[model samples]
Target: MPPSLPSPSSVTRAAITLPILARAASTTSAGTAVTPNKPPPSKDHHVHTYSPEAFPLGYTVSSTHAGIKKKAGALDLGILVSTSDTPCSAAACMTRNVFKAAPVTVTSELLRNSNGRAKGFIINSGCANAVTGKKGLEDAWSMSNTTTSQLPPSGAQSDKEGTLVMSTGVIGQHLPISSILDKIPELIRTLDDSPKSWLDLSKAFMTTDTFPKLRAKTFKIGDRLIRMAGIDKGAGMIAPNMGPPQPPHATLLGVIATDAAIKPEDLQNALNYAVDRSFNNITVDGDMSTNDTILCLANGAAGSAEHGGRETEEKMKELTEKANPEEFGIFKEQLREFAEELAQLVVRDGEGATKFVTIRVKGAPTYEIANAVAKSVANSSLFKTAMYGEDANWGRILCAVGYTPLSPNPISPTSVSVSFLPPAASSNTTPLRLLTNGEPEPNIDEARASEILKEEDLEIEIDLGDGNEEAKVWTCDFSHEYVTINGSAEEEEGWMYD
Candidate 1:
């Protein structure tokens, strides 16, 4: 692990009390969940707030200048620990890339062996330790074992503290193990829970991200207050399509810690649902990373029947058919919203990207088709370049839709319509139709089109005019800076393993 660690400098509202969000199923991402913009049905506006910046109870993070990056004294190696005495429930969505990083392979086994329980995890940014074959795997194990050595161990040899590992940056390179392991004890000794610590930790793990990406959510399980916080880093080699401890993962990279009590199976299910709708729905440059991983740990520090910072060991109900659906629904939505916020941050900070675009493909025959078409348009280099130049090149967008292997046969060029939606907070209620029924508009409002595309954030709406199924994907525009950065990356000391 060589590239990143979170350096947290977050602000927490001690008085913050989040309102209850409704449990009813609604329409949104992947054509199933609630829309990212839709607020909870509750009259109160506090049901969801994006950046509470508070770490959940019982979690601590720290990073050190491990010299993993080429930059002198840059904080690289970091550790995030679930400090509860009991083994914390853990779940992950890992990259589907066949050339999985050494850390990824080791962490997968750790989770598999521990049965969804873990204590602490470590991440490094600099050398990805990918494509190094057996020796790379050994280094990953060393990273895990070294981390386990610092923290108190958990049950069973198969479950040795669940010391998961993650790495990012230059591919096919060996980690400076001695240089990193020397700092592991110091990282542990300096572990902290301060907002500044979280901010620093967030920044440490970042590669090309201009700013640290982190968010927090709060809710109540009965009278007990539950909190969820997440931090992630990635500015390139993104487009996470992770599975539930299966073939793939997303976000490029993310770590979520929560105090909400949940069962192992329920935790896995919630992560799968949230990730598929959020992280899996985004693409920046359409590149999949070998080390992409998102791990969620719940220490249950604020479980029911607790107060004054004391965590109860009492078993809480896991989300299941036998449990309360409302509470479970709220948990899943909060998790999704948290992941979505972080995932969006990845796009907003995409390397050399100047615009964040949302592609909404509606009236499709199926959710999969809608998703595929939307991603196809979002990932089109021509379309992205057009957006970069503030050009309403709607043909480029539609052409992207034309070649989709998953497209419907009836969806001829004439079967679709394309429009540029107004930017967020803009007063314009009407969309500027660039192409309607697959025909270019007779009188193009070039001025208005320029105005819409000039904004830093843009929205593209495509109507297949086929069926009710719809999907939304988030992406960024291509720019000359993207090329410049990639061109000189290797000489600059490191580049992400795409």
Candidate 2:
């Protein structure tokens, strides 16, 4: 079972009292006024910031502080809206964790009720609405209803037209629904489709993250240009297992918006394919969050006939049968590439991470075996620490691969080989072979191997010598600072509630 929330009596009283305290401070007598004690600043905000270069067409983003976070002027609430004339097509990948947050539950129901269509998303930081049970669900519904109420009426409103909600930060706390609802009008009025708005929205979603993650790309499909922009927030508890929207359980929240108008099924297929190679292949702390969500909204505002139009049904059918190399291949590849870039940025900005590492496994009998082997090596603490210390400990790498239990087809240690390469910037460097056929290579240069490990980025390649299938996993070296950041997180937030 998930963690239990605070006792109802104490929680209810605190919740009812906080708003009264804020209001009391403004009350004044004829001659004098009384001042209420102010809460301490939140320790959650860090120095890292970001600036976005471009934003997707037909989308506007904005953020504001709603007192969920104690820090003054910190952006704790945000919303992203699609401004197309018609409803936008949507695709989502959610976490598979059993204990889902309120927002995750609400979003999943909304998507199913609407048949994969939505107009906007509302996100909040500093209070993750998990473990609050029935009341949490009610609060999440209130958030969506308030947002929809504030928007201009377009025809009739249904669950499908409701905005998606996402929350991050401290777990097991009830959201300050009153404060959040009060800010809906201001948040709606400030929405803009400018680059700065996107950047601010990205920053508003951050928690333990040291920096914002944002990426944008434009692809041409026959004379018309379609643009996609994405922003994500994760620095801890960052392993993600996002899949189709049915049983949502991933925590690293990401939002991708595009101007291409594609069928919902086709968009969902593309999102799952991209996630398998990108988000699913990276690990920060090897722990998954209960609120992981990746959503993509395509508004088709680019006026591109080739991408989406009256013939969308036929084009989607053709894509399902077999991608047309000349037509669909370019768009598919661009989407995958953009997702991969964003995934890499997540690792690069990992909390206290100093070295970015890539683990590649080849020659496996199946893609599943290849992925298992790569992740085992990438998530091993001994290997990560060895990299942080600049130690060329190839034995640790080999040990991790040897323990990956491959069912049906057992791996033979005698058929495995390992090699490490220097950073790409070093043109004169050569890859150092550590093992051949499971034995240490003769006359190996330990000095050169150690030199390669000193670079900020490195790659380790492993060959199972079983078949031709391959997989790649991205990770970062573990450092002392990582422990320090996590060790103090709970203490920092604990003071706020007290």
Clashes of each: 36, 8
lDDT of 2 by residue, 375-490 (tens): 98998887887677666767677667766766556677678898888887986467888878866787677667767876778999999998999999999877777777676646
RMSD of each: 13.3, 14.9
What TM value does model 2 have?
0.83
Number of colliding residue pairs in model 2: 8
Reference-based lDDT, residue 9, model 2: 44
**Alpha carbon lDDT of each predicted model:** 0.75, 0.75
Give each model a TM-score.
0.84, 0.83
Q: Write the residue-wise lDDT of candidate 1 on 85-177 in tens digits.
A: 555888999888787888888888888777888887898877788888889999999988888877755333234456889887788788999
Give the C-alpha lDDT of model 2.
0.75
Residue 366 in candidate 1, Cα distance off native in Å? 1.7
Q: Which whole-number lDDT from 0 to 100 does residue 178 have in model 2?
A: 97
Top candidate (TM-score): 1
Candidate 2 regions exceeding 4 Å error are: 1-53, 154-159, 247-250, 304-326, 489-498
